[model samples]
Target: MTMSEGDLAVTELAFVRREQIAPLPPPAMTTGPLAWVRDNLLSSILNVILTVVMTALAVWVIYEILDFLIFTAVWSGADREACLASPAQPVVGACWPFVKERAAYFVYGSYPIPERWRVDIFFAMLATGIVWLLWLNAPRRDIGAFYFFVIVPIVSYILLTGWPLIGLEAVDTALWGGVLVTIVVAWAGIVVSLPVGIVLALGRRSRMTTVRTLSVIFIEFVRGVPLITVLFMASVMLPLFVPDQWSPDKLLRALVGIALFASAYMAEVVRAGLAAIPKGQFEGAQAVGLGYWQMMRFIVLPQALKITIPNIVNTYIGLFKDTTLVFIVGIFDLLKTVEVSRIDPKWATPVTSTTGYAVAAIFYFVFCYGMSCYARATEARLARSERR
Candidate 1:
């Protein structure tokens, strides 16, 4: 409709703004760190009270821990007297001196001092392979995988146990102890478990009845029992069934048991990841003419494994700590060494056991926390890549 002459005359007298209004800044309460604090910690009166109480408690606990670990700790000297409270030092905290004295024993245990260099070499090789594999941008990652999953284990075996052909002395597994044994048990379990778990997970889902049945039986049987029982059976009962000459080393048995136990748990984690995948994924892969193995490997397994990284890492962390259980079989792991050291009459003091346990706690925390951090980083990286 055309504007009437009278309307036009009135519109001409009215003023109209010609430019867009500038946008206002976001509200002050919604845009800063203080906003986060307020929203999360002080959103309600009850939350405010809880936050203050928790913060104060945290600070107090931290202060107490630092005091026990550092402020009153004994740093040097020989024997129990060094850690004992005296007139000169009226209070004692951690017995750093005790840890200092037994540091070598804690690392090498009964492994011969001169031959301990072999263990050091193994550690270096293991670290090299791990860094090579885990460094996403590193060159020749396939070779890194080979180095980590294949060469390292073989060379490590020869290096740690010795080889006559290589002019190395044979060090019995009985002599393996301390951090050496602990890392060995954990590394073996971690390395073997994942691939075995994948196969078991696949078998559990297989169309073949016999394969599925066997997989289910193995997984259920292992999961039904405690790890300590597995350790005992492997370390003690297995030898009874095998020929005397065919019997495995005690450490070997425990390693097998640990690997089996972890694989069972890992299989369940993998299966959960697999179940989370939609049927469309399987159908789409087949629609593209992919074979069963190719579909699983390229189209399915990667997604499944990635989905379960957190659970996989959780199982690994538990297995790492579970290495301490080998002590029940007379294997001297890191904790076992600490246990042995605390009982030494020379260093016996009120604080000796506490200090030893504190060291063990720190060791476990550092490694487990490192694994957790790495897993989180991997998850974040994967999420970023997917978003792009």
Candidate 2:
């Protein structure tokens, strides 16, 4: 029964070791969503406070949006008289009825009611072509080449100009108004500006001093001037430059101005892409015995353009929105359509401001959103191929 000091010492050491080796407190409970959240949002008092503030702000925004859109609209709609109460006492929610009434005009402009099917067919073909282009795994270059080089121009011109080889009546350009005009201007600008931009960018970097100097002067000069001034020049000064008997259509003049302005901007964007390319790319081209044009077409430009597609798309989006400024030159684009709508005596209620603004906002949102989505898809496709 009696134990030695040695025995007691051994027993005490054994107990200490057991305590130290007790599974290490279950490894501190790592590797779960809760742990991740705690690490990210609740790790410190400051983080917790930030999280709470953001959540509250988000909830408040959602509640306000719901109340304004759903609740207010429901209240106003329950009493039809309340919606049309007065220009001063108009419903606080959206005037969707105004949109419903004039949406066709917004879509097709002043294109004849009887021949609206032409616009429909044109849009359908364009949509199909776009869908094919956006399918990254598809035979893009071939399909897109057809869409770009052949189909698009023919379909768009026929629908817009209505030169009517197919029993459809001709629609005068003068009568065109609304979102169609916006699209017409943007599309024309995009197509015309791209080739012009490519040339200008190449010229700016060309070995020929004359070409380089001229490109620099033109790009900088156009970019330096405001779009409004360009539109003004297209409308006013362009006539003076032309033969006295040769007056171009107003829409054509606006298109030329928009294309020129957009091309200048596009050239700068392309030039930035060109400059970002490594000198070694050019050297590699030469090492391959490729000539200047071949080197640019095959090696340098492909890589440079891949890097700049996102930037190019952004520039296009800006150009698309800027098409609205053609209104300054008396061209009726989407925004101008809204401006014109307000002058209608029947629709010219005190509510015209809200209605017109709401329509324009939606039109812009649709187009700009589409362009942004296209840019994202293009970026994703490029990323998958290990290109920026």
Off by over 4 Å in 2: 1-70, 74-82, 85-91, 164-166, 243-245, 343-345, 348-352
Highest lDDT scorer: 1
**Which stretch of 10 consecutive residues in model 1 shows the poorest summed lDDT?**
72-81
> What's the alpha carbon RMSD for model 1?
3.7
Query: Of the candidates shown, which would achieve the greatest TM-score relative to the real structure?
Result: 1
How would you encode candidate 1's per-residue C-alpha lDDT over 1-388 as one tens digit per residue? 9999999999999889899999998988897988899999999999999999999999999988999999988988888989999999998999998999899999999999989999999999999998998899999999999999999999999999999997999999999899999999999999999999999999999999999999999999999999999999998999999999999999999999999999999999999999999999999999999999999999899999999999999999999999999999899999999999999999999999999999999999999999999999999999999999
Clashing pairs in 1: none
Q: Write the per-residue lDDT of candidate 2 for residues 231-307, one digit (tens) a residue.
A: 99989898989896797889989998999999999898888889999999999889989999999899988887888
- Each model's C-alpha lDDT? 0.95, 0.79
TM-score of 2: 0.81
TM-score of each: 0.93, 0.81
lDDT of 2: 0.79
